[model samples]
Target: MSYSHLLLALSVVFVWGTNFVVIRWGLDGLPPFLFATLRFAFSALPWLLFIRRPAVPWQKLAAFGMLLGVGQFALLFLAMRADISPGLASLVIQVQVFFTIGLSLLTLGERVRGYQLAGLALAVAGLAVIATHLDATLTVKGLALVLAAAFFWACANMVVKTVGRVDMLGFMVWTSLFAVPPLFALSWWLEGPQAMASGVMHASVGVWACVLWQAIGNTLFGYGVWNWLLARHPAATITPMALLVPVFGMGASALSLGEPLPLWKLAAGALVLCGLVVIVVWPRLRTALLRTNA
Candidate 1:
């Protein structure tokens, strides 16, 4: 990638990474489901007015929207609200890569490579380490919720793969539209109308900014630039930049939220990040080794 493009990729990941912190900020004023509802609502409206919907079936759009907006983000917001710190949330959610692999194996009959298995094992170990160390910042409920969110994210990935290539931005916008009603219903049912009303009424300007950031900065701009880069470059070239997300997530959490980076947390991060590295890098390495042997 050229220097400018690399910087662009970095900016996207930075937005994505810091998004956990933004979610934390938003949750301070709004209930989780309500926060999610507003985020998707803004993400879809006005833009969806002008942008044409992708050619995919409405069913597909609805499914992806629920999985992403409700299953993934709603749960994620809930977890962040009470259970997990933003830093760890950012790190732990990445287990979705492994979940995606596992789902593909079962659903699509895709073969798993040794490196993928190795990566899974390493990531599992890291998660186990986290499980053993739950405290004020990291709770059992938080970890479980985030893991569930990761599974939902993997499911969303399957939806995308099934849909094949379409206008990703349009797909996201339309799917986001489908996500809003259900999320509002969920907020009403679970968080209670009183809570939602109170949150909205009492929300600060900063909280609203966080909500807008989630819609425009994190969802639209982040994915917009990312897809643009993928269109211009190979997936292998573009995708690996995602590894920086957790690094930035943890760093931002520490810097912004004063989240502590204890030694154990560092070790766990190393293990998980190393596993991700192996998963992303091993295929390229294997191909290069085969050519060398030839």
Candidate 2:
């Protein structure tokens, strides 16, 4: 990655990692679904005027909107509201790699590499460690919801790839626009009028800031650079940057929220990082060695 692209990727990790804390703060007054609705609503506003339709078709765009913008964020927001530890939530959501891999195989007939398989194993083992600490109440439903969120995100990834060609920023803006109504409906049906009213009345500036950060910083700026990098470089070169998410997520949680770093979670994180490094970098290293010998 170029220095600028790397910076944008890091910015994404930072914003997304800290987003757990922001969501937690937002939940203080807002009901979960309502907060989500307000979040996307605010996010879609600036882009409503400026963003053009993506080159992708409406069918694919709508599906992408439902899966990614609505399903993923909605389930994730609920999981956070259910009090899943932010650090752990960050860690667990990385399971989207596993889901993405599975979807690619099923949809695109891509083969899962041996290194990816090994990385998946290490990641799963680490997730087991994290799950062992969950309270009984937090165990079944909340975790399931988060996992569902990951699946939705993975499905959205498939949609994006399937669409083949579009401006990623345009896609994001349009999908978010498609996301608003359903989310508002969900809020109304699930959270009701009174809670929404109270939340709107009491919503803090920080909450609005978080919404903006997620919309502009994370979605537009972050994915803009990422899509550009993917366009310019091979997946082999760029995909490894994702391994940084867990690291930044855990670090940000610790630094911002004073969340304790457990030894097991730390160990699992290290393993995941190591596994991803081996998967992403080892092939390049082997090629370099072969060239040197030749």
Q: What are the Cα lDDT values of the candidates?
A: 0.81, 0.71
Q: Residue 251's C-alpha lDDT in candidate 2? A: 74
Best by TM-score: 2
Residue-level lDDT tens digits of model 1 in 1-294: 566887898799889898888998999899999999999999999899899998999999999899999999999998999889998888778777667767776776767667767876776676667557766888889989999998897788777667666787898889899899999999999999999999999999999999999999987788667655655654334544565566678878888899886788678767767766676667778888999999
TM-score for each candidate, following the candidate numbering: 0.83, 0.88
Which ten residues in a row are the worst by lDDT in model 1? 234-243
Residues forming the 10-long window of minimal summed lDDT in candidate 2: 231-240
RMSD to true structure for each model, in Å: 3.7, 2.7
For residue 169, what is the lDDT in candidate 1? Answer: 88
Error of 2 at 116 (Å): 2.9
